[model samples]
Target: MDQSLKSPGQSALEDAFHAMFELTRTKPAPTLAERLDRLARLRALIANNESRFEKVISADFGHRCATETAIAETLLVLGEIKHAAKHLKKWMTPQRVPTALQFLPAKNRLIPQPLGVVGIIAPWNYPLQLTLAPAVGAIAAGNRVMIKPSELVPRFSALLKEVISTKFDATEIVVTGIEDDISQAFASLPFDHLIFTGSTRVGRLVAEAAGRNLTPITLELGGKSPAIVDRSADLGEAAERIAYAKLVNAGQTCIAPDYALVPEASVQDFAEKVQASMRRMFGTDPANKDYTSIVSDRHYQRLESLVTDAAAKGARIVQAAKPDDPAWKTKRKFPPTIVIGVTPDMTIMQEEIFGPLLPILGYKDATEPVSYINRHGRPLALYWFGKDNATRDEVLARTVSGGVTVNDCLFHFTQINQPMGGIGASGTGAYHGEWGFNNLSKLKPVFYRSPFNRLADLYPPYGAKISRLEKMLRFMS
Candidate 1:
């Protein structure tokens, strides 16, 4: 569609898309030096504006923890850039495959080529990492990139646009406006690939739109990712890790342990330990700098409704702080809460709890956790804390998830060599390090045939030679 005929935000998105699309068409493959330079510039952009990014991201969140921002956003992004730059050369090189004995002297090479113009639709939570991490791969793969950051983080989005614009030509890379009108149009563009990181509900819409253009998509969607506390696991250690993972960014993390499945005998003790850990780390104080506020009033209310519904349904409400206290609500910081005696009927159990709320459910035996998880949609991440190698291996083998982190929480995402993505409803496709580069590039297979081959003899009129050729093929098979 023409820019003049569309909404202002849509028009701007169209302009950016066309510009990068045209550039990619003209210069399809970017040299190794060019890719490394882009990665370096991106690193510098984050490094130079570390404080500014932190400040705006916090402002967007009402009050995000500075340490969390540094560790989760800035530091992770820097690590990705460093990793991509270091391994890009090897990733770009083609691999040789063995040729068939019948086609002697012929060769097979899988060449990696740039897929032009990759579009990224980033979610508000972990905005920086989700937005630029994919770009690192696209850039390393030699594709022009476009990003549409969430409108929820307007301050960070605007700043990102400003900084990215200064470092890159619009045709090389562009951060489009986050205005509402731009959103629907952004997904409809025919890009070589599209990546959307958010809830599964919206992921469906993005996937549907991308399907129309036959645009390949990578969805990093969230679901009710669970952490199982095995009978053999240390209660204190498991509680501490799950507590930190759940409360980080006030549990807005996509892979945050949505609930804990503990053995029936240890459920109460484990839940209390987790509550203690939450108090020890972030504390009950509404003004605690370590605690983060909910992103907006709407999200805050949704969380409140979940708690209220759970309480009304007869579940025990365990709070690190006084739940009725006005201080937490006033600051938009939900009191660190844990819900117990939760049944499948409760609203909290039905949906992805993207808040600081953790529901502790007891399992009858080791087999129950695996069976329960199997009954639901596949989750993006699953964590099992235990020392029992046999039991752990059984759970790992029986259930499927996008990724698994045994004995810890959220560490699977930090491994640069590993592919970070979800499976089924939680998400689709994977990317990080070489996985990202390969996902963004087309690994085209090229076969070289030698002129001296006699296979063409069978292509003519049928004769006794044809029978001989059939016998040879059968022998090879």
Candidate 2:
């Protein structure tokens, strides 16, 4: 692309990168007071504009419930800011470590320092939380940030850009909502560190682009996260919790339960209970108050294609709410759907169903679900619901996922102290609380020698004295 023809977003991103790079060269890391000031400004900006966030996000989605935005986007970011503010002092302190036995009387410490510039590519599902939560961590760690929010949610992105422009300087925290070409261009920049949260497909592109610059990256990619219901589990409570987690944001969350594994005999009963739970939450018609629409027509059609393909491939499709009338086609709202008799050959079974679709498969033993989860790439989140400690421990010990929630769903994400991220294809590295601070900072190691050090005897040409000392050490060993 020609430089003159570059989109404004692309131009601004290039400018921000240069500006931040220059700023960091002069002021490599902000002081504790400066960082706290930036965080305070961010908190004030979001807290004061809660209503605007709700309104803009609702406009971006056809009809997003205000409370959902309050809890997921605005409130979650606020919590992250408060948590970072409280812990930044401790997290920034140098950690003293014991020196190895070979280096007696030497001092060792790990000092945390900020990386120069960080780039965050946010996803559309939870735009505010994904975009600003990372910024909070970066600022707390004293790094400059450039955010490229998803273009699918235009109103929310514009509003976010406005908020950032008003409250933050470009070199401090820059935000952009650009076209795909510009996003690709932004991803190619040589940032000190970068974080991208989206599909594995696009995450691959971003990862490849960053790799060219040797930029360290954290890719929060999606996968088929599973929930297992052991035979000894409470079926009704499990169904209700799983339904609420899966249907929130219309199953747009990256960590939402993608499928459920139930004991063979209770499959039908569990499915019925999930249906009832959905009805209680969103009535028979799945009214707008609690249900959220698909983000775009393209995503809606892709979800529709998955359903049609699964149904054609001998899968039993069931709605969690009411009839799957065609009227929902125009409204862009899809019901919480359930699928049974799902086989690996079906499209729904293969892809990460990011919409309001759930597939329940039956397993004969506790080991089967573990084996199934192991066969696929590691998931971002896994859920296990049961009273049996043996089964819970077995699953936890056997399966590898980014995180786990027991007897419920998504509560693991709410714990700010724990790190949230994926392993293998799902994601790498974690970000939250103190972990977020350390992940974004370079913990440099320092070793100090005392003035009375006696190591000079071993430094020369390994003479008789060194040989004698080595022999004495060997005898002690």
- The CA lDDT of each predicted structure is 0.92, 0.88
Candidate with best lDDT: 1
Over the stretch 10-102, how does candidate 2's per-residue lDDT look in tens digits?
887788799999888887579899999999999999988999988888888887888889998888999999999888889999999998665
| Prediction-by-prediction clash tally | 0, 0
Segments in model 2 whose C-alpha atoms lie over 4 Å from true places = 1-9, 320-326, 472-477
For 1-477, candidate 1 gives per-residue lDDT tens digits of: 654689877877787898888877886598999999999999999999999999999999999999999999889989999989989889888998999988888889999999999999999989898899999999999999999999999999999999999999998889988877788899999999999999999999999999999999999998999999999999999999999999999999999999999999998899889989999999878999999999998999999899999999999999866544688877889999999999999999999999999999998977999999999999999999999999999999999998999999999999999999999999989999999999999999999888997778788798988899889988988
lDDT of 2 at 10: 81
Candidate 1 colliding pairs: none
